[model samples]
Target: MDNRSYFLEEQRCVKKNGSQEISAHCDEELHFDIPPTAAWGTTEVQLREDLTEERQETLEDTANAFQGRGRVVRNNTHFCALTSCPRILQNKKKGKMGVTFRNSASEGSIFIGKRTVKDGECCGVWDVAGKYSIIMGPQRKWMMFSRFIFMDRLIADSHQYLEVRYRNGKKENKRGPLSMFEDPIVHESIAVMNAVTVDAFEVIVVYSEDEHGNVKRNVVHGPTVFIPDVNQWLHVFRWHGSRGKDLHEKVPGALVFTKLRTIPDQFYYNAEGVRTADDTSLTVKVMVFFQLTNLEVMLNSTHDPIGDFINALLADLMNFGCSYSYEQFVQNAQQLSELDTFPVMCGRASAIGFTIGKVVYRGYAASTQLQNLCESAIKTRTELKLKAEEQEQRERMRDYEVRGAHGRGDAERAEELAKQEHQLAMRAAQHQESLKQAEDAHSKALRQKEQMAQVELAAKVAEEQAHLAYLQGLKDMGVDLTQYLVSKSEKQPDKVLKVVTAPSHFSALPINSVSHIGGLNIHTNV
Candidate 1:
């Protein structure tokens, strides 16, 4: 057979030797053969606003698993009376043991109530469970408040604490008939709550002192820091809030925040009662920018830091203006830029916790009579320069025309030489051709003369052959042909006859009566 036994984490079983032993906090059952007597009990403990989840559970028994446990703490209800601040609520718990509120500045814890806690006891033991209420108070010196309450209940339930703190000179005032229960305010260095938020343009300086007793500084730029009391280990220094606009009144020992930005339209000056290098006076307007830097150091250094910076800037500008003539300054007025002013202004402003950013020359103008004279001089100079340039250009044109005429003369001479050479070559070719034709004609004439002479000689030879043949024929016929011809010629006197008087019979009869000489004798005629 098995015997059943159960216990909780906050429960401790007492033995005969007075030593104690604790049990598991879960719903586990142990089997014991002897079935020794067992009793259930609880511990009484105080939970601060910042206690962790694991540590809080150690102060409770296994009875915490019961439904609706530890729900009656007041500060845990998410109640805040700072009317200027907005609240955002999100309920994330589920089932019967759900969380209904949330706030970082104030918090609460659960309890198994109706138990008397001893002075040095971290927890109290209880025989039976009872109703629980909230117990809340400040844990830092800067969190001290002279008059703090909500919905007619004491803010910290410290009536006796107020009277004690008031008599100690730690607080200036106390609230109501509940002043008898107060305690002295602490954390004079300053404490900030997580409920506070800082803007992007703002900065919070956590001022304190080091171990050597000198002042120390910690900077917070925001967006925000969630917790401020966690940094109270250092001593107090100084605080400044909201550089842009007024947001909160001075809260003693609270984190002070402020911003850094440019202050515009600060320095507007008209240049007057000052003469330039040329003794010409002009009107000039200028502007500048100013910002805060080491504010804590500045307060101790000077009563009016901004005024000192402005005066130094104007004095330096006056000196710079004297270095340039009226025309020179107006022509290149932009030379009076930020680079020229920052160095001089910063030198004087460093003692006042201010920084110089930019300087600008807005505008400038001269007197009307002086401006007219300047304009006339400028126009005259421009006209003279134009006339000189025109004369130079005319000289260049004359030189070009002369060069062009010389080039045309050289080209014409070359063309004439080429024409003469061509004419000489054509004449030479014509002379050679005429000489060849004359030679050909002379040769033809000589050939024609020789041909005519040959034709005449051939004709003479043919006539002589004919004559000889004729004479032979007459001889062959045995006729006296010469004599016949002579007789024939004698009958025709116009015909001439040549006679060879080798004197044969033909010659002998050549006398005038040869008519009958060959046949009949002519004795009577003789």
Candidate 2:
């Protein structure tokens, strides 16, 4: 048997010549044969059959890959088409002005210096000739063509607001992102203005559209979100106007430029009223502090909210004043500031989106008649106090006098007691001395009696000794002693004589009988 082989292939390519494109085919195949020597032989062949649609699609994909093209549709007719050369805008100096415009007249139609337009071109040079309109397109886009314009001294300080006003009446009020440009947009329809800054210490009632298409109202402190379109209207209500200027004299219009900071409004009123109870008249000075709370409500409720608030405040003050007498009003004047009487007033203002911060009673002056009565009352109180003090002083003096008299009496009594005790002591000492002297005299008398007794005893003893000596001398001269004794007895006849006989043995008794015999009678004491 002989070996056989067959192969089929296809290829496609895209060819280009300058700007022309052409599609062509490149396909080849080969057949192999064995000769008698068993060597290999080859034959080239070209296929001429039509390809299937699927195969043709594959061939087209291969052709596209070769051409280096992706599957995206693009139109080059209107892509950056310009009729003439684009002029590069010159950079403006820091203090110069320019004009800008946008052509929204037609599609592929732009105006440049009144020249005729060509086909498939959309841009042209714009200068200070016509009105600038933001071209609205099918893509809902706006286009502006302009050069930069600058200002010499368009500064917005921290206390100033830079306001931008467009020709369509939209406004932007801000404080920061500072620039030295009056009108930053190089367009004839726009202008740069000034406004008082809404500082952080103040609030502004702004009317704006919300996401739900409702006209929303709220307070804004300082700069709000920025918007550059000229489709919205704006107005600012401030407590005060620009510095060094009055509110009425502040330039009006949406584009007027006056940089300032927001401050709270303070209203001072000097009013007169008659008290209800006493018919007394009073002049009062009061201060009112207030701020705007909502722009839409404020504008809707009244044409002039500030003036309305002041009038309402005065009415409320007078109403409150009528409730009390002159004295009561003077004493309770602070009640004017109380919110009790302000509810009705506050309600009227709050309907217009205005709030009262505070109300201060500055001062009040009464009539001359009331002043005289007050002075008299004060004088009376002073006199009463002085009288009470005088009475207290008199009582204190009387108490002092009583205490001094009691002290003097006590001193005198003490002195008298001391003197009496001293006298008693002296008398006792004298009595003791007298007793001592009497005892001494009694002792001396006893000694003298003893001496006298001793002398009498000595005299008796001497008399007895002399009598014995005389008797002894009589006994020694014994010549007639018996006779002498008898003679002496005779001479003293009254003297009794006694005779004594010696004791004999026969007669031991009867001595009296014997003495008689001896011729002498002797009376004897034996």
Candidate 3:
């Protein structure tokens, strides 16, 4: 609390002490040796004493103004002591030069510099030093970048390939399972295209440039790979829909046909309100089958083969149907399924490189009234035929019965005739036996009569011989033969006979001398 003022010179002090003496207060300087690693290195610093009174007063007044504030104020205007510090010295360290780029083996980018590099090659410090750029050339110009393109399995199996077209019109083909970047020519390629795959049953027509650069058409068969050149392309085929009175809408489309095998197709047609010869209206439905024979001829002859078939078939059906009445057509409807019914269609098909296989008249449709009438007529005709057949069967049965009765009667009459002939033959045999026995009895009686006559003649001859001998002996004894004859005549008087008609002169002679009396001469022993 003592308020007083005092003054002190340099290097001296005034104190409360009784005697005056020399003061130790003086301006001192301090030196600090900072190392190179610190912010400031190898520098000197000085500490100054409070020597000015005015500066002290000014500080005292500032302190009095902020006496009750609880915070201290600092002056940082001269916090740094160095006058010119070199800009914060940075450490000098070496680093890598080039930017890193990463990519897969299947993918790649073009880098242009002194030389081109691709196919997933790495770029290092040496590349950057050589001024190489990715997908860029000198002056940062854009360049071509390509990645690996894989062919599909189906295409590869079919022997298909890819064609690379160059900017100079040079063409080259590459097979599948390859990368574009692997080949150096890819850098100069303008485009790459896949080749067309041909199957076993297919064919293709193409327009291509020949060796002389002239465009010409050529046909390529199946089972091969068709790689077109830079100036080659496939031929486009357009198909038109069928057009006819029976068709309501035209069908339009594009298709490629198979030329190596047989192709089958069918179509239906209807003829409405068609009149027959008997003025009967009918709706006829027709179906047809066709096959392609020659493809070149078909292309040249017609634009729509199916349309031609329908038209031709319709014409033939109309001609045939109109020629017959309703009844006649019904009887001959079977002819419709035959090939002869569609002569016009067949001829047209052959001309247009096609063959018609079969034609079927699906049948006809008529009004209800006409159908009912036809059914009635058929029923009546069938009934009449059945009745006639039954009558004929009855007549045949009656004729067979009559023939059987006549055969039985003829058999009985033959048996009766045989019995009568047998009886007549037995009677004739009995009569012949009786005649033979009677003739044998008459012959035996005649033989016995002949034997008896021969015995009697022999006895008479013996007696006459004996009598002559007796007469001869008597004559020799002088006996007379006349007496002996008389004696024998007397013994058999009945057998003796006399002659009455003698001469008159013989009667006069004696009876004893009759032998001489007839002549008038007797010699009797008189």
Candidate 4:
């Protein structure tokens, strides 16, 4: 028979061996070519007898018989068996297939002719024989078969973990460096978590739930990694300030002060429209440096430490502006660097667990009019100072000139006095030498006169003795001594003339009596 255009109905009755009747459906396509000997019957006994004779025949004879009739039995089934039996399914690979029953009301359960198969229970091929129905079957019940879901092995690293949730609403944490086969019972995997790592200078604050369900906090200091428990959470710090607005908005987690090292922050404060003691308005700019000291105290005390510092510094600067005059403030501007100037800031920092390291007075600005006036005053004062300095310098120069003139005069006077003293010394030496020469000449003349006188006296004494002896011989035949003296004076006429010019009247006594004249005392009376 050619069954190419034949389609089965919802409830089709087929007669087996011309006697037995059966209601059935065929899900697969049916195409058949059968010989006259392999035709169907209306009776079950005839169907069974035909199937036994076909099985007893040789395969080539059956195929030749079908070929002679211009038809072929592809599945080797006789026409009577095709209309009475259901199809069979087989698995030849390593995976699972899902067989869902259209008539079963519960999940993973199926109903056979007289038995039931539930979940987690194994079913043999025979148990599922009539349980699977086709879409066009007598009951119109359809079975849906799912494709294979391959079993695979999962691996996790040391820093990774898996969160598994079951069909029963139970959760489990699977941490690794390990490999595990996928359990058939697990429903799904929720997430994969990696460990948080920190350096030696950092720490992490974590909040977790305890066994009693109470929330607890802890600090983790590292050079290490931190793997949080399934129920634990990390602490996030949020800070807001004028300087940090954009930074905080973009990366809020960066403000979490995990570092244990010292941190420095700067804030600028402008105290505007402040009135000085002299009623002068001023605007002062002050910069502040601050650091965090104790994290525990900070968390317990305040939410925004930078904001607190800014407010406190502004308050202190305003107070200072109100207390001092412009000049006083400028003169004592260095006082801002001292911690004592920021009492409010210091107190607030201590309360909020921060340390105020230093404050800097970034000078000040005033209204345009006030600035111009101050500049004018400064210019006038500077001009006056310059003029005074110039006059002082001129006076100094005049004094120097006068001093130089006086010094030159004194030097000239000193030189003149030195020259006069030298001349006087030379004159005194020359006078001394002349006096010595005169005294030496006088002494030599006196010595010569004395020697001449001594010689004359000796000669006179010798002559007088010789004359006496001659007189004694003249008394017995000698000449007179007076005649000898006259003869000696007559030989020297210049001596006679000197005697004549003598202060005595000895010229009148005659040459013969001139013995008493020329420094010779002869006892001759005339």
**Model with the higher TM-score, candidate 1 or 4:** 4
Residue 61's lDDT in candidate 4: 24
Off by over 4 Å in 1: 1-198, 203-273, 287-291, 302-306, 331-334, 338-343, 375-526
Candidate 2 structure quality by residue, lDDT tens digits, 84-170: 211211222222212222232212211111121222222322234544332211122222222111122344645455565555656
Off by over 4 Å in 4: 1-199, 242-275, 278-283, 372-526
Query: Per-residue lDDT tens digits of candidate 1, residues 17-93?
Result: 13444332211111111112333223222233343332233233222223331222233332111111111111212
TM-score of 1: 0.27
Tens digit per residue, CA lDDT, model 4, 1-526: 2321122221232324435334343222222333335444221111122222112111112222232223333466433233321111112222222343222111232221112232332222212343322122122122223111112345568987766677787777778776543433454544566667777767678888988999988878777877777688787666543345432122222344433434566666666766777888887777778887787888789877766776777788778867888889778778878899889989999998889888888777899998998999999999999999999999999999999999999999999999999999999999999999999999999999999999999999999999778777766655566686677667433222223354465556653233444555354333
Candidate 4: C-alpha lDDT: 0.57
Off by over 4 Å in 3: 1-204, 207-215, 221-274, 279-291, 357-361, 367-526
* Lowest-sum lDDT 10-residue window in model 2: 77-86
Highest-scoring model, lDDT: 4
Models sorted by TM-score, best on top: 4, 3, 2, 1
Index of the highest-TM-score prediction: 4
Ranking of all candidate structures by their lDDT, best first? 4, 3, 2, 1
Task: lDDT winner between 1 and 4, please give it.
Answer: 4
